[model samples]
Target chain A: MFYREAGEFKTSYVDDNQTFPIRFDRYRYYFVLFAAFLVIPFAVNDYWVNAVFMPFLIYSIAAIGLNILVGYCGQVSLGTGGFMAVGAYACYKLMTAMPEVNIFFHVLMAGGITAMVGMAFGLPSLRIKGFYLAVATLAAQFFLVWLFNKVPWFYNYSASGQISAPERTVFGIAVTGANTSAWASYMFCLVFVFICGILARNLTRGTQGRKWMAIRDMDIAAEIIGVDPLKSKLSAFAVSSFFIGVSGALFFSVYLGAVEVGEAFGITKSFLVLFMVIIGGLGSIFGSFAGAAFLVLLPVLLKNVLVGMLGWPTDLAAHLEFMIVGAMIIIFLIAEPHGLAQLWRVAKEKLRLWPFPH
Target chain B: MSNEEGYVTADGRKIGGTLMEMKNITLRFGGVKAITDISFDIKEGEIRAIIGPNGAGKSSMLNVISGFYVPQEGEVWFKGAKRPQMRPYQVAQQGIARTFQNIALFEGMSVLDNVMTGRLNYMKSNILHQAMWKGKAEKEEVENREAVEKIIDFLEIQSIRKTPVARLPYGLKKRVELARALAAEPMLLLLDEPMAGMNVEEKEDMSRFILDVNDEFGTTIALIEHDMGVVMDLSDRVVVMDYGKKIGDGTPDEVRSNQDVIDAYLGVSHD
Candidate 1:
């Protein structure tokens, strides 16, 4: 009943070109949003929202961002962690320098600054491509994290080599740092994720999205077909950076409260995000969300179910989680390169017919 | 504005309005020369073919015209003005479009979306409009679909509109690529070896589509073809290249008669 489209007629051509053809899909999206905003907070306790769900939402946003550049645009980048660091650092700087500025604006500005940095790294993509270009982005990750750590100004001349969020609020609700409540933080991040998800969807669905995909599909043919690789590739970097930067800002300010430069947004973090996108689906917008959610929730759920409940050692549980994730990536690549998004689609298809799947 | 923009030439031969002109292009890749002082003109509303053996830089020529590879020497003039050193998108903005030799249809995309991407230049709405799926973006999508549908009809690819490009046959994929190119409504159309890998029936179908595109749209076509018969039949004039140099230029019959072209095709042995 949750996915039934009995009578929805598409009268106009505009209606026919929708991302979702069925009316059930539209309502389902609305229902999910409703549950996320309303039902989710009440259903789970504060610890669950803060420790698990909030971080997952935030990671999804960053995964979606990296996916735009790496997946959709066909640009290989290992600097997502660096860009995320830029976001977090930028937010810190903005909040300190302009105390009166809205936390929302500061978060957005962080993303904007990250976009500029992402573009700078993306310049090398024009000269180099494939694995060679990927190596160039790895340089971005190393150099940026190193620079941020050394630069005292980025950390506000903190005595310790770590930056922590200050008191930040939105509409009288604590939304950042240690003082923030679990529900408020989750809601804030969830809202940001919602807006950014919609933004990513729009961007990838339009001329910009088509341009990136065309380049990803085939650069030479893309050129003949009138796609400017320079503009498209850079735009991918900019938009992707914006999402990641914002996510990083949230990861520190809302979720983590405090983060050391090398610790939080390191190369491992970059790989984690990349893995999320890869396992979700390459060259798919929805795949970014599916991947982020699957990867984020799986380990936590696994550790809890396998270790916490079954009384296994934490090390063994962690190892099992890693192996499962690794094996799934390989299987997905060989069996269904589209990842969990494809799985979700298949599930939806079966749901459409219910008893009669033939 | 293009180099030939608003210019008129009342010549004895047919002045179909110079849509695109590659002026004395000299392209070199380090030690090897790709195109050596080659010059060609495409008249508006004419089907001009570039014929050459392998390694004659036929693809290189198309690349230069499409702004993929910049020529070392010479200017590309379009519609009566000196064209800027434009990107591929800029070239498209100047009302030029192209198809690839290997059927460059976006493999994972549906035939409809692949063709729709050709109208990317014309889709005016911004990200905000697209996000809301609101007024301008919706209207633009509708307009784009209408235009693409016309191209689909022209290519007779009605059934495979929703089918992914990867699943389509080689002939259908090539036609879809053409459909995608034609969707742009380009003033200058470039097709690189459109019938190179096609069977006899597929070649005939592609030829018919090409003729219809030129006739119906008044599009100026500059094609590189291997099949001599298709080149002779479809094109008004042929520019033959040998060793990156223009060996013969004129009507197909004239190029066919030229002894240099004959020698280039059938290697001339020194006495």
Candidate 2:
């Protein structure tokens, strides 16, 4: 009953075009944001922060990036892992080269660098599309990982192939490195997540989003009606890679603390993020979060339930988790191809009409 | 209707001079010629129709006008400027908008969003501004929304503003396509078989919208249609094509009286 928009009227176009036009949705979103920023960090400890929240937030960023390309702009890409590696490597290079610069700027710049890389890779998209484009990006994935692994300069000519994050602080509070507190790192990633979420939502609802969607839904019609395919596709790539890069930077410096490129951002990483986008719902920012949350929590939940509570072997539980994820992907594809975001929308839609069926 | 003073409709709306001219536009696909030496000029503030039997290259002519298929040899003149070889989008940027023969609505978006897409060329804020969604981008978005809302209102699709284009009926989809083209606020609007699958009432509504668009906005319109009644009633002038050649081009009555036009329409044995 509380979800209804019965008497709540929008007075202007500005009001109508809000990300959450309904008063209830707007307030609920504010409450979620409040909990995420003000409440969650206080209650959560290291285990929850490191194991659950960080991966969810970081993967949500990557998924949002992928969704913009594959979902919004209809460009299927398999190079997410490679692009993320670019971000990670770029961040690594910048962190070592300029020890004095803020980590925030480094992360943003890493994203910028990845955007250029993404645009360059996106050049082939203008000529090839669909499966061919996916295969092209798959090449990007393999090539990027291989490049990072083979290039010693990327690792600062270290004896080992691993590149580790040095101690970094913001306002005297350590957000990265071995000495960092759980809450500081959590808050840092949380801030990026919040900002990125807002930026993505804003971009998708405006002109850029329209152009991308127009290109996605019907490229010929879009081009004929004045959307430049090159701009839209490349912009999608640039924007998507920017987010992916940011996530990758955070993935390395803040989340992982050290990375061997092949082990960390492998092909599976690409598929994992793709799974999040597919299971979450393509083309939806909220879906990115939903997919990330579901996938992130699944393994944890399975470990506790299947291994801890049920006394199953660890290997068996891991195998079962894989099976469950595979089954979930299949079920989601067959049943609700739009993913959890669409389910949430339908649920909310029904809630709006609760207690009375038309 | 035409004189030394320039053409005027019976309703006394003055049709202006040539807005777009096609000079010897010959489009070929491989060894086959689609359009051969077809020349036509569309006057400003008038509805021009291209009509022919199946395989007469009518759609091909529309494609040439919209820049989907660049002619092998010809020049397109727009408002007295000789248009160079350009992509379809560049042509759209040059104040031309069109609907496809098969309703090409962006099926994934709401009616409002699909129509808003037509406002893309006018939306100038960069991605940075768009991401922030405050100040410049917000102001531009709101202003363009105002313009789009007007087109939505004009087309009377206010009720289904937020409905996805895929969910709408075929008739409404055609109207949505028109609304999208209109959202561009082009100097010239092209409609490809707008009433192809419409019922009697829907066709009348579309015809009225076409007339009102011309009367109110003074938009130059070029259309391809199979419905002879629609062609004769809605168009100020008609171009009849047969076998990739312009058989007749004149006022509807003049074309109706042409003997060659009769043979093309009624079919005559050539073999």
Candidate 3:
């Protein structure tokens, strides 16, 4: 009864096209945002922040980016790790080069740099598609990793070839480096995630998002109806990389504190983000968060239950984690191709049609 | 059929000058000739039709006109300017919109969203404005939405506006495709088999909508169809083709009386 839209007549186009048109949905969204922004930081400790919240928040951004390119634009990319590495290294370089600038600016500028690199890789997409495009992005992944590793310039000629985030503060509170508190880093990442989430949501619901979907659904017809493939595709790549880059910057600088390009931003990182998009739901913003949270929490929950509670071996828990993830991905693909989002939609539809079985 | 003759249709609309002209177009695919030395012009305010049997290259002619296939020898003239070699999107931007023969609606998108995509060329807000969705972007979006809603109402697709195109019936999907094409508000509309697979009732509804679109909006139309009755009743002029070559070009009655068209239709041995 509470979920009905019976009398909520939209008087204008702006009112009709809102991100959450339902009153219940809008309130729930605001409640979630409030809890994330206000309640979580005050109540949570380091363990909760490090093990669950930070990774979930950071990876959600990456998932949204990949979903835009892979799900909405229909460009399969396996080089997300490489692009993330670009972001990390770019953030590192910018932090070191511009010590006086704001750390937030450094994070955004890192995203911008990764966008250019991402677009460079996205050029092959116009000429290739499907599995071929995936391979092309894989090439980008390998090439980017190798370039970052072999080139000492990216690492500032360090002996270990690892780029580390120096102490950076926002509003005089350290948000990066080993000296920072967990809450400070959490708030920092949370703010960026909030902005990125809103921006991604709005972009996907608007004309730009429709253009990407049009190209994804039917390129030839999209072209005949006036969607420029080059512009639409490259814009997807650019915007997707921007978010991935920001997430990477946060992952390395704020979350990880230090990273070697090979081990941290490896090919497996790309697969992890791809799995998040696939298992969460393709072409949905909420699916990105759902998938990221599910993946992040599953590993932790497994470790806690299997290793901590049941006294199982750590190695066995890790192995079991892989098996569970693999099985879930296959099941999600075969059973409900739209992943968690479709399930959510079905549940909502049933709720709306309550007491009437049709 | 002189080029200068301005014929008035029964609805009292004057068929204006040439909207789109194709001269001596020749399209070849490797060793196969899809269209050879074909010429046709769509008047500014008339419904033109191309009728032929299977493999007559009617689709190929439309493709050539829409810039999907580049002809080896021909000039495409639109509104008095010689059209340059361009992409399909460029042609669309030049005020030419078309529906596909296979109903190429974006199956993943809602009917409303699919129609809204046709306004992409019209909505020019930059990325920043769109992402922020304030001022110019919001205003342009509302403006476009109003226009798209008008087209939806015109097509009588309001009930299924929120439904995905994939979930729609075949006839509704075709109507949705028409809605998408009409949303572009093009000067010249190309319909590739608008009634390819439909019942008689659906065909009648589609014909009425097409005629209404032409009469109300004054849009010039060029459609490729196989239904003889619907084609003859709807189109002001008919271009008859067989085996990649034009056999007759005139009003429906003239083409119907032509010996070559009758022979082509009756499967008479041309050799």
Candidate 4:
């Protein structure tokens, strides 16, 4: 009864085209934002911040990026890890080379650099698609990792071959490095996530989104109907990589603080982000967030319930986690390929028609 | 046809000089010739039909006009200019829009979004503006939506505007495709078998829409159709092709009376 939109009349096109057309949805979105920004920082401790909130916020950004490329644009990419490395390294280089600049600009700059690199790798997509495009992006992933590993300049000639974030601040509040308070860092990543989410949602609802969807649905028909494939595909790459890059920057500088190219941002990391997009839902922005949250919480939930409570071996829990996630992917692909986002949509749809089964 | 003044039809609709001319066009696919030295002109504000049996290259000629296939030998003149070799999108941006024989709607999108895609070239706001969803991008989007809504209303598909194209019936899908093309506000509209698999009522509806579009918007239409009666009733002029060659080009009566056109349609006994 509360979810119904029976009397909500949209007299104008702009009203009808809103991100949340329903009055209830708009309020719900606002409530969620208020909780994320105003309530959560005051409540959570370091363990909760680092373990659950940090990874969820950061991976949400990465999932949004990959979804734009694969879900919206229909260009399969297996190089999210490599592209994220570009962002992390670029942020590292920016942080070290310009010590006085704020950490916020550093993250934005890193994303810009990653976007350029992402566009370069995205060129092959015009000539190839599907599994072939995935393979091409995989090459990008390996090549980026190797470049970061082999190049001494990237790690600043450190003997350990690891890059660490130097302490940085915005408005005299420490947002990075060892001395940062839990709330401070969480707020920093939270702000980025909020901005990125709004930007992504806005972009997807407009003309740019339509062109990308057109290209995805049918390239030949899209071209014939006046969408330039090159522009649409490359822009998807640029925007997606930009988000992935920002997430990577935050991941390295704020979240991890110290990362080895091989260990932290590797092939597995790429697959993890792709899994979030797939299991969340394709072609839906809310799906990206849902997928990220689901995957991030799954491991933690499995570890606590299976190992901590049941007294199972840690390694067994890890293996079981793998099997469960694998089985989930298969089931989702077979039953609800659109993922949790679609499931959520169906639930909302049903709720709207409740009290009667029409 | 050469008169500079341009004459009005018996129905009081004005028809102008040729809008597009295909001169000696030849298209080949490595030992296979699809269209061979065929020539035709589509005049302004008239419904033109290209009719042929299966594999007679009617679709190939349409492809050539839409810039999908570059003819090896021909000059395409549009509005008195020798058209350059343009990508299909560039051709579309030059005010040419078309529907496919097989419904080529973006099945994943809603009817409104599919129709909105036709206005992509017209929606000129940059990525930044769109990302912000404020100022220019939002304004341009509203403006385009207004235009698209007009087309949707004109085609009487208001109820299914939010429905995904994949879920629509074949008849509605065809109508949606026409709505999309019309949303482009194209100077020249190309339709490939618009009434291909429609029932009698559907065909009648489609024919009325086509005639209404031509009369109201004054859109110049070029269509390839198989149903002879529908083609004769709808088109002002008909071009008959047989095995990669133009057999007849004239008014419906002129084409229907041609011996070669009759032989192509009724079959000839060669002894």
Candidate 5:
């Protein structure tokens, strides 16, 4: 009875129409923000922050980008890692080419560069859809990854064709390379992610997002109802790629520090982001973050607990992580096809009705 | 209405003018003809019905008119403008909207959202205002929602406004689909079997709504249906087609007794 959503007074239309009208929900959201921005950073050790939380957040952002294209727009892609590679390489190129440019703008411009490349791959989507569309994207993923590996210019003319990060500053504050502190990196990531999150939320709620959903739901019906499928679909790709590209840039600059194409961003990395989206919630935006965190942290936590603390073999811990993650993926899919986002929603719902059977 | 086919308006509302003109519409799939030289006109604020036996290209004609299919030979004119072969969206933008034979709603989205999707083109809210949830975009949203709510009220779907379209019953889903088409506020509406799978009560309810839609919104309606009784009561004029050819075109009473129309349906098997 105490947990019910009833009697939540919404005096004005503005109050009534807020995304989360329930008082408890709004409070809970603030609690999460506090924990993420204030409490957790203070409490968590540098090891956890550097090795797990930071990577997870970056990957979550990338997963959010992929979910927009694949889950929301109904266009499956296998080129997330290729876009990431573009972002990483672009970031590297920007830093070296323009010594006087700020690191923050460089990272963002890197995101924009990836966006252009992602759009190029996304162009094939106009002629094809479904499985064929996925295959078409595969061409971009493979070709881009190969280009970064083979082209010396992408690697800044290095002999090994691998670009390494040079320590850089944003407004005289350290952001890139080993000299940069974890707090600066984390704060930078947090701020950018928040902005991107807000932008994405707004985009999905408005007319452009509706057009994409219409195309996703039923293209023929969408067309008959006055939604231009071609332009709308392309816009979905553009917006989706823009976000994913930015996430990729952030994942490289802030998190990885130094990057190589084949090792850091590749086909395997694409699967990593896809798994995050699948495990989080297919179309749910928050689910992308949740899925990314779950996937990113599971292995690290397993390694630490099973190997570091328990003195078990690294391979055994690795195998166990795989087994557990695989099993959870199956369980999550069977139990709730909507993913961890749905699970989180269910938990919140149950919490809302605690101590009441009805 | 037209001088050639006199349309008597209900309640003396002069909501009449030819909105869509189809001339010599021929659709062919390989050697088999789906529609052969069928010409028809739909007048503004009038319910025009196309009735025929199975495979007589009634739905095919609707599809052609709505730009789902490009007729091999014909001219489609809308609002006194010559219609080129446009995509379905182009037709929709030209003040034409349509519902499908099979209900195609976004199962995941709420009824309100589904209907709001129909007004996507009209609601020109960009990303910036949406991000801030203020200014022009938010204003446009409220305006569009008001229009959608009116349609929702008109269709008596206020209770199920926030329910997912998939959770709705067959009859309600059909109505929600209609609400969505209405949300577009089109001058012409094409309905492919509006009351296809309804019970007697639902059919009557739907018929009343259809009539109200014509009188209230003054939308030009072209529907393909099989139910003879409803067609006779609802349509100002009925066009009869067989094997894609217009066998008879006149007031319902004239076409109901036409020997050629009767022979097309009863004369032979799948003729």
Candidate 6:
């Protein structure tokens, strides 16, 4: 009853086709954005920024990227970690080489570089599909990790073979490397995420998004109906990798401040993002954020309860975290293959028809 | 009424010059031949039907026309120009649109979205414009939506516009597929087994819609069907194939009286 569009009418196609057509939804969205921008920066601390907000925000971008490819485009990829590494490494190279430029440009350029790499790996997808494509992307994951580790040039030939973000500022306030405040880093990543989210949301809701879904639902039919598989698939890879790369740039430069390729972006990292997509929902933007938040926050919540409160061993809590994530994945796959997005959809549907049993 | 170039049908609609012509088209999957030395021309604004028993390669011929299969030998001509070796989307860009033998609607997408995809060829806004979704992109989308809405209304699928194709019944799904193909506003519309697996009422509805679409849009149609009754009622001309060979090609009544077509349908003795 409270969530009704009874009196609200859309007078124009533009009004009807908005991202959030309902007044209530639109307001809620604005409120969330307001809170994230105005309120969170003030309230955020180093502990909350590093442990909770940073990971959630960063992974949300990655999940959005992976969701566009696997969820909307129907191309399964397990090379998210590798693409992120490409982003991280690209950002690192850009920062060190072009120290005079803005860090924002470096992040965007890093995303662009990763997008090209993603499209290169995505070529095999035109000839292969399903499990075969998955395997091909797995090869990309291995090759990329190997490239960063063996090539020492990627790390600027550092003696330690690790890439570190140098001190960089946006508007003269440090947003990367040491001496950066928690809010500075948080706001920096937040800006990227917000822009990425809008771009992704708009792309998915428009003509391009329809083409991807058309391909995902039925490739042959999509072709007959005038969707170019090459353009669609490659564009999906380009856009998805762009987001993933930006997140990777932020993950390395803003959040962690230092990174060893193997330790930072391994197979586990790939699986972690994959799990976020699976558990959150495959073909939903909201599910990306939901999955990222759920997975990112779960470990911290578990750690606090099990280790900090109950005095349980750290390793035990870590093991339990793994088991819980695994069990959640299985449950979501079995119970609701569409993930939490479907659940949210059903809830809204019910709310729409409230107070009357059909 | 008889015209200089082509004759008028019983309903007084003048059929125009050749829109698409297939000359000596031969298709094969490795050693297995699908269509052998088949030649046909679909006149503008006429309903051309291909009918044969199982394994007659009618579907393969449709595939060739739609550019899904590249004939090992032969030329496909559209609008008096020899079509190049191109992809399906290229063929679609050339105003050739088709529906599958099986319902090929995007099962996960709403009927509106599925139909909207038909306008992908007409969408000219670049990726950057689409990402921002303002100005040209928004205007183009609204324009496409208007076109799709008209088709939905034309097909009487307005009630199910927002419904996913997977949730629809067989008949409705078939209609949605037709709506999608029509949304392309194709010059040459190909329908493979449009009435397959439908009840008599559903078949009648499909036939009526097909005729209405042809009459209203003046769309040149080429279809494959197993039902002779629907074929005879709906198509102006019919092409009969048997074992990858064209057995007969004529008007419905001419094909009905052809000895070879009767022999092929009745399983006549080879000796």
Best by DockQ: 2
Interface RMSD of 6: 0.7
List, residue by residue over B66-167, the lDDT tens digit for candidate 6.
888999999999998999999998889989899988888898888888889989988999999989888999999999999988999999998988787889
Alpha carbon deviation, residue B109, candidate 2 (Å)? 0.5
Residue A101, model 1: Cα distance from true site in angstroms? 2.9
lDDT of 5 by residue, A1-358 (tens): 4346777775654565566678877788789888889987667766877888788778877887888887778888988888888877787888899978887788778877777777778888888999999888888889998988777778778876666678788767788788877777887888778877877776777676677777887877878888877777777777777777777777777787767778888789888888899888877888988888888887887788999899989888888889988897888789888898888877877877887758
Q: Which residue pairs collide, candidate 3?
A: none
Tell me the alpha-carbon RMSD of every candidate.
Answer: 3.8, 1.3, 1.3, 1.2, 2.2, 1.6
Docking quality (DockQ) for each candidate: 0.54, 0.91, 0.90, 0.89, 0.68, 0.88
Please write out the lDDT profile of model 3 over residues B117-157, one tens digit for every residue. 99988989988998898788889999999999999999999
Q: In model 1 chain B, where is the ten-residue run with the lowest total lDDT?
A: B1-10
> Candidate 1, DockQ to 2 decimals?
0.54
TM (B chain), model 5: 0.94
lDDT of 6: 0.92
- lDDT tens readout by residue for model 2, A1-358: 8688999899988899888888889899999999999999899999999899999999999999999999999999999999999999999999999989999999999999999999999999999999999999999999999999898999999899999999998998988899998989999999999989999999999999999999999999999989999999999999999999999999999999999999999999999999999999988999999999989998898789998899999999999898997887798789999899999999998999887968
Model 5 chain B worst lDDT run, 10 consecutive residues: B1-10
Give residue A186's error in model 5 in angstroms: 0.6
Q: Give candidate 3's whole-model lDDT.
A: 0.93
Please write out the lDDT profile of model 3 over residues A68-91, one tens digit for every residue: 999999999999999999999999
**What are the iRMS values of all candidates?**
1.8, 0.6, 0.7, 0.7, 1.7, 0.7
Q: Which stretches of candidate 2 lie over 4 Å from their true place?
A: B1-5, B269-271
User: All models: lDDT?
Assistant: 0.86, 0.93, 0.93, 0.94, 0.82, 0.92
Model 4 C-alpha lDDT versus the unseen true structure: 0.94
Clash pairs of candidate 4? none
Clashing pairs in 2: none
TM-score of each: 0.90, 0.98, 0.98, 0.98, 0.95, 0.97
Clashes per candidate (backbone, < 3 Å): 10, 0, 0, 0, 0, 0
Alpha carbon deviation, residue B77, candidate 6 (Å): 1.6
